[model samples]
Target: MAFDAVVTDLDGTVVRADGTVSAATLQAAHALSAAGVPLLAATARTPTGVAALTTLAPHLAFAVCCSGAVGWVPGAPEPAWCELLPRAEVADLVAFLTRELPTVALAAYDSRRWRMTATYQAMRPNTHKGPITVVEAAALPEAEACTLVLGHPDRTPEQLVAALIEGGFDPTRLGLHRAGRRFVEVTAAPIDKASGVLRALRVVGADPARTIAFGDMPIDTTMFAVVGRSVAMAGAPPEVLAAATDHTASVEDDGFARALTALL
Candidate 1:
């Protein structure tokens, strides 16, 4: 298929373990832009987290953040689109989760800022970014959140999801997704990377059938479902691999660059 755009996840797809984009990946992005193909960032990161990509690739003007609840161009004062959870619902969910899993740390984000419980704040490393406010879980009702993040130092992503299910969170009512080994995220129902990608596609006037996507996690499955071609990383989970149209080398092996070379 002739692709008009290339969408990729950030953490495990294009970024290396040292939290840097490889030279090969950067070259591929430049090549795509020179060829008139748009390169978009689709990630579970917050707007703040996605902003970091702009410094690495100036061609990346558009990004889908918070799994799909928000879409924006880095450096823009406002987002192009945002979907937030109702205040009442945010309060209820936090109340229930804290009661059920007292050990889990909770973090919440609106369109502009991230706030976490004091316990969650204390868990951050010295290298963690600033501007994240420390707030009580009870304050969740005061802030309209686009995403709610649950983290447990001891539990894996799978365990966190299982615990949420057992705690009365209906997976169908919310986008319950495991973003990584230590974090499980909850967004408004039916929002995922695919929703963000579709919004980005519309913004860019790109065709779904001609859009190629690269991802490595279950949250990325939604994007895979909508795109014409889905490239899963070598080390992607079994389900992600099964859903993809093709497979590429692991990120550590410069899989993104290799895949882009073949496709471009």
Candidate 2:
């Protein structure tokens, strides 16, 4: 392989539409690793949410989860890198979101778990998880949160963003990026899958030029733009398509497998 490593976005990138990584995708990743290329998972999902892959690609070095708020080095019992919401901010933001959009979903991130509110508990079916602990917002501690997630079908993410600003929300510390048409995720400004990958690159001594990224949504745009060569899913959003160097097959079509084979 010309590249030293391969970094990928989860969800609609390497993972199938139903939240499973295809047998071919996992096989290709293992093939990449067997060839001495490191495979990094860069996703908006939390470490716990990404845990299912250990059963598939266990040798992966690190995973960029919760966008970039959490990073777990492979084989480690705990996260090697984690960034959470400031102690002063989490509660206020939660309060605001609760008051304004009572049905909005919220998530917490730390070394051991990715906790979600009762509202998000029901949405777990759409989430890729294992041994999940379901709890209420009242059951959680009053500390920093890595990110606050909100998704609604009747309201576009753009509209929610507008409403957030109108409600005196300061986006300075927040990050909002798309997942799909019906979903948008918000995290701390410092954590994004792209920044996380770059940090991992520095740790591994691999440059962006020697790297290739693949994704299927707007959240993956940052990673795509940073890598020298990026292949977007055929079903990717316009922004992702524009950011990618080329377009590949959709997730259901095994686009990542084809892209990885070409990289070799």
Candidate 3:
């Protein structure tokens, strides 16, 4: 079905192994924008990670970042609105994770830049002061980072995810997953990409049946299940492939572009 809007996951679904979107994909985004269709970036990536892509399309609206902690609208030059796990809760969670799973990495975002408090070196090696100013967590003062990444790159996030759960963190309070072997994340309850995108769509009065999404992991399964039309990456997990309503090319093949253009 042709869609009125499109939302896409980053990483293995939209970005190629080289960490770039295909020219055809960018063109497809522009085509949708020029036609007045709203295109949104949906990812488990924090807002900072997706910030650079805001300029990808002039017609792009808010991004579903940090798995939806922030409804980032760079178009406003300032963020429009956001939902964050409370600072105190974040601090407490960090403290809890530290005492129990001391080796586990932890981080949070204030909607402008990425920050590190634990052991995430996957990002550009940089330093900044964060809100709490605690010596334990790296702080980024004036850190206008959009995304907050957390993980222990030395170990598969699956290990830490298991550790965190066994350490006493209630599953109902938050969610956890490995972004790749390189990273794992924990976010506020309901941080799944599908629900996040759904909330964003509701705010704009978009209809689910008219919306199409492209994704490539278990994290995106929620999004696929809810959208009227969802496409899974050819490279996605076997489970994701089984769950998708349709399947498309791999990220290298411009899966998102193919799906969007067909809908358009």
Leading candidate by TM-score: 1
> Per-residue lDDT for 154 in model 1?
80
- Would you estimate the TM-scores of all the predictions? 0.93, 0.88, 0.82
Report the Cα RMSD per candidate.
1.8, 2.4, 3.9
For candidate 3, the 10 contiguous residues with the lowest summed lDDT are 126-135
Candidate 1 lDDT at 86 equals: 68
lDDT of 2 by residue, 2-104 (tens): 8877888877777776667788887887788788888888887766666766654485667887777777876667876777766556666667777777777
Task: Spell out the clash pairs found in candidate 2.
Answer: 44-67, 45-66
Q: Which portions of model 2 miss their true places by more than 4 Å?
A: 126-141
TM-score of 3: 0.82
Candidate 1 lDDT trough over 10 residues, lowest sum: 122-131
Per-residue alpha-carbon lDDT of candidate 3 for residues 171-263, written as tens digits (9 for 90 to 100): 677667556545665666667677678888886678888988888887788788888988899978888898888999888988788877665
Given candidate 3, what's the lDDT at residue 30?
78
lDDT of 1: 0.83
- Evaluated at residue 111, the lDDT of candidate 2 is 50
Worst 10 residues of 2 by lDDT: 124-133
Model 1 Cα lDDT, one tens digit per residue, 69-175: 89988678788888997677677788887787787788888887778887777664432343678888888768788998888778788888887778777777788
For model 2, what is the error of residue 167's alpha carbon versus the real structure, in angstroms, after optimal superposition?
Answer: 2.7
Each candidate: how many clashes? 0, 2, 17
**What's the candidate order when arranged by decreasing TM-score?**
1, 2, 3
